[model samples]
Target: MTDRASIIAVLSALAIAAGGAALGTAGQVPQPAGDAPIIIAQATGAQATGPSAANTFNRLMKRPGSEPNIQPSKDGIHDPANPGTALLQWPSEAFAGFPRTNDGNRVDWVKTLAAGLIRPWTELEDPEAEPFLMDLTIVRQVKGSMPNVVYPHLEHTQWLDCTNCHDEIFVPEKGANQISMAGILLGQKCGICHGRVAFPISDCRRCHSQPKTAEELRQLSEKSSWAKQ
Candidate 1:
């Protein structure tokens, strides 16, 4: 009799659970307090204007810009920068394996190698500060392929403003910009400036001396923000 009672109780509990699940699936159960509202609709390919549409719902997720609301009626959102440190990160043999970047320099690879063995991705290129006196493209220190960190002076000056790379972004190169692509891209040379203000070095060929396509040329062009790091 006790075994039969236990079996009956288990069956009753299971029946109750099934009924609750059915109600929940039918969208009849009320959501707990403080949860985001649920959306029930089919997503479309093209644009959709109605509130129930997925596009409109996605717009709700996007936060507007930080600027003050000029017109209360306008519901524009501000876009936030990508996640990753504001500071740039470049390739290191300790991380990428085999060797450091192809551009040979006077960097001390022994300590860098040691650090890499202990912490595979630990070592980064922080080149020594010697007097750089040459006109070369500036490179950032982020990770990417295809001349990742490259910058030319005359062209950048054409599109950017004076304050774009003054005392803030880079120290004046003899009142004229002069740095090497190797150091900058490595984050030790020209990255001293472009890494912060100009577009990140992760986007390669944007400032390379040799660009094969028009789109790439455009990517190197001045963006709206001065600080895109």
Candidate 2:
């Protein structure tokens, strides 16, 4: 009883899904079409010798500091006719003289904040509103040999309010949210900002900073118990 139109639509959907699966299986994503192809720069600033595609998730995940050849046409923004879009400044000029990093736009955001080069407003409406900075550190123990992650509130609070993350991207309560690397890569949880506006998850050591050895954890636990008594 299916009409010809319905059959055609279903086949088209299946074809699209199949194409996506093939791309995922091959671990390759289509690069934006442009005259200049984006390339990942070597540590020595030399061009990587190969036909390897730039802006691949695996490549970015493995290495940081890939200088992309950004262009209006290939910038991923769909809007072209908007007048304000043309006024937007390029990344190189905008981020000039800022502290440098090995990963994510090659700008050290934390150090930049410390150096007072740029003072981001805590709120958009009220420019005078001050940031609510906190010095609390949360150490999350990871499974297996990976080092534990240390989430510093002070650095983040300086740029954002607590409400920015609470009850939306992340649940305020600990152990309530389930986070995974896959989810993060897919632009979920910390990935919301980490990959887009904030620093991309390039180096694992950047987040996995705390060392949670059994002896160290035991000693710390004992000290905490004694202090509580």
Candidate 3:
């Protein structure tokens, strides 16, 4: 395999390991010196210089008329392509299986789930669905205009238990999670779990960190994103 492919493979393995460890046993995987040693960190330590905290998007601060959940189609969200409300909302509640909003088109997402919703997974918990409740297309809320990559969620999930990330770090839908860079820098949302448990954002390369190839960059571009503006 090419070097980039190798790197990707290793990184994938690390995520599986970390997330699995956190999920498989009791909820307490040893942290990696504040930031776990995912392959991204293996590339460099620049992440230590960036935002070490993670934040869940808060709905109260949402811009008026913003899309509010994942599975946007379900919530009647129209065109997240524009920067308006799209940027302010959590990317989860709109997911297909996430949970429907009180409006009847949305889903109860991570934040809602955490705030207190008790639904089991459709995968391991239930044989009626796939391994995960939310699909990549739905779960990933990356923006195209941002300079950063889609948050290293899959990777971080490796070390962090689902409960640590989901339902807390961010809600499945927009606005409900309450993640803000300002709040994250202060230790909320993604920061709440990542700052001390998963790899700290102190390293610029961890989240904003990039692959060593143009192809990888382009590939990431096609995925979910919030940097499009």
| Top TM-score model | 2
Candidate order (lDDT): 2, 3, 1
Query: Tens digits of per-residue lDDT for model 2 on 46-148?
Result: 2558544343334333222223424454366636677777777777777789988776777888898899888778778998888888898988777645678
The true-structure Cα RMSD of candidate 3 reads 23.0
lDDT per model, in order?
0.43, 0.71, 0.47
Pairwise lDDT winner, candidates 1 and 3: 3
Question: What ranges in model 1 sit over 4 Å off?
Answer: 1-148, 174-202, 205-229
What total of clashing residue pairs does each candidate reach?
11, 0, 62
Tell me which of candidates 1 and 2 scores higher on TM-score.
2
lDDT of 1 by residue, 1-229 (tens): 3345457768976876897688763223343343444443335444546454543443323122212212222213212253432233332322444334322321223344435443323123643322222345555433222433444654444334556566665686543544565777767544754455444554345455343355554555534254365
Which number leads on lDDT?
A: 2
* Weakest ten-residue segment in model 2 by summed lDDT: 60-69
lDDT of 2 at 106: 77
Candidate 2 residue pairs that clash = none
Model 2 global lDDT (CA atoms, 0 to 1): 0.71
